[model samples]
Target: MRKAMPAALVTALAVHLLAGCAENRTAGAGTDTTGAEIPEKVSAGTVIAVGSPETKVALQLSGQIDELPFKVKWVQMSGGPQCSEAFRAGELDVCSAAEVPSIHARWTGLPTKLVAAEFRKDPHRNPIYELGIAPGADIDTLEDLRGKKIAYSPGQAQGALVLRILARAGLTEKDVELVELPSTGDVYPTALGSRQVDAAPLGGVNIKRFTTKYGKEGGKTIKHGLRDDPAHLWVPTESVNDPQKAAAIREFVKFWARAQVWIDEHPKEWVEGYYVKDQGLSREDGEYLVRINGTSDIPADWDPVVERHQKTVDLLAEKTGNEPFDAETLFDRRYETVAADAVADGRKGS
Candidate 1:
């Protein structure tokens, strides 16, 4: 478990990051405690602490970061769990993550909402993960998951994917051993390679690397054959309630939406800029990533998105014995069309 950050230290970090912002504020730049309305324009003094490395890379590579209306202090956050910790510490305003973070936050009583949601154009064809079978494991299919020791991270997408896979296989938690583990960095692949768990979900370049290193030892990967692509820009509800931060978040979402389109339209540049240059992956590996991820899909209507989220919540609740609340509460409908509109406008940095 990670240790809690000291409050004073968090405050100092926030202040230091925001110290260079313009002193003069735009009209209607004050804080809004009533939650009645969000400011339409971002204030000059507004500085949003964002924790999305992928978006940062996209903006920087495409020169969109130079055109932002407000200041951004980029925070180094790895995944949903880290983002939640930063949100709890009042150090992060917004983050890009999977669907599990918002569900996990709400389950843990942290007030957060999904400001924007996205998915792959063909989710099954471009799944974010594949089940990695251990070197000596006898598993060959989803049904073979029974009686196996599976790696699980309760508040993460991989963990949820495991549950969904088991459900598809018509199995329950009692049917297999769920070894608790953190799926950060090379942990999952390392655990699978060591035979600590029979099967674990691996994503991005880890999928290819795992198979190559361990294929000689009988390691293999199986397609989960499930829709595991859920991309989101989420935030603590407090940020949306504040007028200045809310305005900045709104603009950020527009840019974020356009960035997805930009990446799809310019795959070669994306591979060169993001996967190879920024991430230090080989050109072949980067090309594999681009092929697997396919294209972006930002829906104009959130009703279907809400339905899918509810199903995820229900499955998670059933597997973990948590209460199943309405998933619609996890979304801020005010910005439902923001991303779609931005994509439609075909603007680089709106």
Candidate 2:
């Protein structure tokens, strides 16, 4: 007969496993550089030095096996709302969300720092923000949308973009009935195909697909793009403007910056995975998205990011009457340095 491990022991093992669930890790056994002991506890904000497979084996022989130097935590969110919850709870040290939430987060004193930027949504290539009306429907222009039903992913960069597009066309939420949906993709089918809705705002990927589909079927092409003026939009939500958070953000940015090159080198893998496997975009379409969105190869350096961020803030403020928080203050330079270093080291990505 065998006895189960003690509850305390079970709990201990669980923490270690959860901590290891994080990405960065350690090294292995005899003839190792550092024969450190396995850490026993984990927390938020600290790095997990023992997660590496190599380190796990080496730590087995070390006597110091009862301490966790840093706390490790994982973040899972569908959109900014979920991330906001984590931010409010003081549960997250760093998070990457689209631009819209970054505004609200900073507005509410979330202590987030914009250390780096990733991809920017391109209008020509990544025209995700669109107003789609049902095929063969009577609706023609923004004026036709009066009192008609519309779908949107509220509180996201896409939703905000859609709103801006409508405003540009002399429309507002007051002019149309708004339907809050998970995303442009979630209700895209019903909002555009189902008789329930007359018009729906969808992202560029959906626009490309649905447009291609309609064109193939000889359906009438409703006006497709309206937000094409600004080629691409950036994402740098909850970045810390200070040096420390800046450093962490730089590492975070480095990952994606490196991913850009890795994506180019291994096109079938990195790019496809982020756009298709992750975003559920089709293979060919995802490729098109890559060309359009233009990867953010720059690190956490503030100059370029500040300029773009300023543009976005100004745009948002003009539309919402809430000028964006001064972007310069929201940044943390330390993390920017990390990103700069990565690129400087020939680790620049696409």
Candidate 3:
């Protein structure tokens, strides 16, 4: 019989084989990239650069920031579009966003993976967005969307939500005047107030601020009546490929999962720390946001989540004319149970 290989050599061979297998896996139908391996443990000097300000605030407020296994260099950034730019530059490792970013990234040929997912406990009651009707637009129902000029952003969650809303209302892009606009800052509300677009999805503090500023002029918002509550923590594939960084990312996901619970358990602190002090919102505005966001729900099973993502991908493809690929490819299932398990363990300890 041939002599057995050394333990170290055997371990090295296994890792090499695993990496080769990962390289053979499809990134997507039209993409030319593949995912990376998940390291078993964080190494010394591991640092995970992050661009999610809300998570940073949550960790800082809850003292979880000090509990991390590795160093995290916080980057002052937010939104999927911005995060994608940083990811492209190789300056950011992880970012938080809604579902559209990953879809858009894959379409744009960027190799990214969603590592964690979260949703509202009651998304229907606490939607992240509502359709804001322009002053004197006379659009009372989703059916009224017909013949209206709608603000659209193809690369953002609002754009995807607009498509979903139209589908729910039994309408199509052909039914409305799609005015492509950047849905950032006060753009949607500003567009509505100035009558540049008859309708746009407004979220967070903008919902109330829009009406408060233009209610006298007949500006109002209506429920979109759909699930627009996909919150995720995603990373560049290259970051996850590095052994140390991958291990650190795994630990970060655990903290992120627990952070959601901390937010739900300590709503007052979250509103104060994240919204008021960190975001510069007034106490009342912060409270309004907390109430609208409701509670966090991190599911143990991602089958249903992946299924919903498929629908989102299908919808985006239907509108954007991009080649539809498997949405499950966008998710790294290695992390499917990481967040849920972390939350469960936290609950047990408490």
- lDDT values of the candidates? 0.84, 0.48, 0.84
Query: lDDT tens digits, residues 245-266, model 2?
Result: 3333334444434434444445
- Scored by lDDT, model 3 comes in at 0.84
lDDT per residue as tens, model 3, 256-319: 9988899989989987888888889999998998888899999889999999999998877767
Clashes of each: 0, 29, 0
- Flag the better candidate by lDDT, 2 or 3: 3
Global CA lDDT of candidate 1, please? 0.84
The alpha-carbon lDDT assigned to residue 177 of candidate 3 equals 80
Instruction: Give the number of the best model, judged by lDDT.
Output: 1
TM-score of model 1 (CA atoms): 0.89
| Reference-based lDDT, residue 44, model 1 | 76
Candidate 1 residue lDDT tens string, 1-350:
22323323432454355333312221122342434666878887899999989899899878899889999999978478898778777789899899998987766556788999999988898899999999999999999999998988877899889988998999987788888788898998998999989999999989999999999999999999999998899888878878789889999999898889888888899899988898898999999999998899999999999999999999887766567999999898888999999998875434
Ranking the candidates on lDDT from highest down gives: 1, 3, 2
